[model samples]
Target: MSAHVLIPTTSNLPAPRPAPDRSGTPTPGRPNRERGSSPHEGERLRPLSRGQVEDRRQELGDLYAEVSGGGPWAWNEARADFLRHLASDARRPGFSLLIAETTVLTGCAYGFPLIGAGPWRADFGGHVREGLLRRVAPGRLFVVSAIVVPPRVRRENQDRAWNLARRLQRRLLADDGAALGVTLVEARNDGIAETLRSWGWRSAGDGTLTAVPPGSCRVLVLTAGT
Candidate 1:
C-alpha cells in the first residue's frame, strides 16, 4: 500500500511573531538585523527521533494549523488530518524528519524510503521511464511526503523558505544515502510546483503523474548531486 501523504496547501495567515534573535545577547543601541535578510541566520536543521516527534506533537499540530489556514479545509480538521498522517508516516521504514528552527520551529520536512518497486511506477500511469525505475534500486528512492514551511514565510522572503525546504530535503536524502528524492504535488498547487522546480526538482514525465489521479498530481524528482 502507498504511504499516507499530506500535500501542502497555501495559507493566508499573518506571519507569526518573529522568533527571538538567539545569535547573541542584544547590545543596547545596536540595530537589529532585518528579519529574513539572511535566511540562514540563527537557523539550524535538526533531525528528530521518533520519540522526539511524539514529544513535540502538539507543537507540530500548531505549526500545521498556522501554515495550513482554514481555506478549503477547516483549521481544526486539517490539523487533525495532519496529525493522523504524521503518525502513520512515522511507522514507515526509514522515516525521517528535520525541523528548521531559530528560537521556534520555522519549518519542517519528513519522508521515508520507498520499498520494493515502490508505488511510483504503478501509480505514475506509465509516465515514468522503465529504465529509470530499474536504475533506482529498492530502498534508494526517498519520497518526501511533506514540506511544511509557513506561507507567510514564503511571502515574506521566498528565498528563505526555498532554502529551508531545499536544506530539509537534501539532509533527508543524504542521511538515507538515497539515490533520488521524489515528491508528488497536486497539479493545482502551482506555487509549490514552481518552487520545487526552481530548487532543481525536475518533473518525472510530461510534468504530471497519475498516482493521485490522472493529471491531478505532478511527480518531481531530485537526484543526489542535483
Candidate 2:
C-alpha cells in the first residue's frame, strides 16, 4: 500500500463559477468549441449541449453492449450512477461536462471527454508540483475525472489506450485561457502507468488509492496545468 501525502501550495484565489439560463438548454446558439471548429479537430473545449450529451450516452450504451455482451464493465452500476450525477451537475452553475466521441473507439459508459469548472476537491492539499503550475492557473478548466476504455484488454490494446489518452490530454489543454487543473482518473496498475506517462502526465506525487476489499480496482490521479 502507498502512503497518502499532501501536494504543496502556492496561493489562494476566489474560484470562478459557470453561468446558466433557466430553460435547461444551452444559451441560444450552438455550444462553443474552443477552437471555433469541429470537435474532432483541435477545437476548444466547451460545455456540451443536453442533446449532445444524450447522444453520446446512447453511443456508450451501444459500445457497452457490443463489448460486454450485456454484462457490466468492472463496476458498471456505479459508473452508470456517476453519469446521472454528471447530468445533474451540468444544470448547476460553474459546472459543465463535455463529451467527445469518434467512430474509431468509445470511452467509459459514464465518462465523458472532460468536465469544466469542475469542483476539484483535492483530498491531498496542494501547490501542485510536476512542472504544471506554469501551464495553468487557478479557476481555468479543471477535469475532475476521466475514463478510457480500450478496444480490448489484450497486450495489443495497450497502444490504443495510450493514443486515446494522449489525444484527450491535447484537446483538453489546448484552451488554457478558460481552463484550470485537469485531473484524469483511471483504473490503476493493469499496465496503464506507462500509457499515462507517454501522454506527458506525471504522477503528481499525490500517492494512489485502492478500492475497498481489494478487488481489481485502483485509482491514480494525474494533473496538467490547463
Q: Best candidate, TM-score-wise?
A: 1
Candidate 1: pairs in clash: none
For candidate 1, the TM-score is 0.72
Summarize candidate 2's per-residue lDDT along 1-226 as a digit string, tens digits. 1211111001111111222331123346755332233223322234455666666665544443343332344235433544555555445444434344454444431222222333433321232343544454544434434333332221122233234344454444444334433443333343444444444544544443333233222333345431
lDDT of candidate 1 over 41-98, digit per residue (tens): 5578999999999999889877877666554456677678779878878987788988
**Alpha-carbon deviation at 103 in model 1, angstroms:** 1.7
Q: After superposition, how far is residue 191 of candidate 2 from its true place, in Å?
A: 5.1
Q: In model 2, what lDDT does residue 220 have?
A: 36
**CA lDDT, candidate 1, residue 87:** 89
RMSD from true fold, candidate 2: 15.3
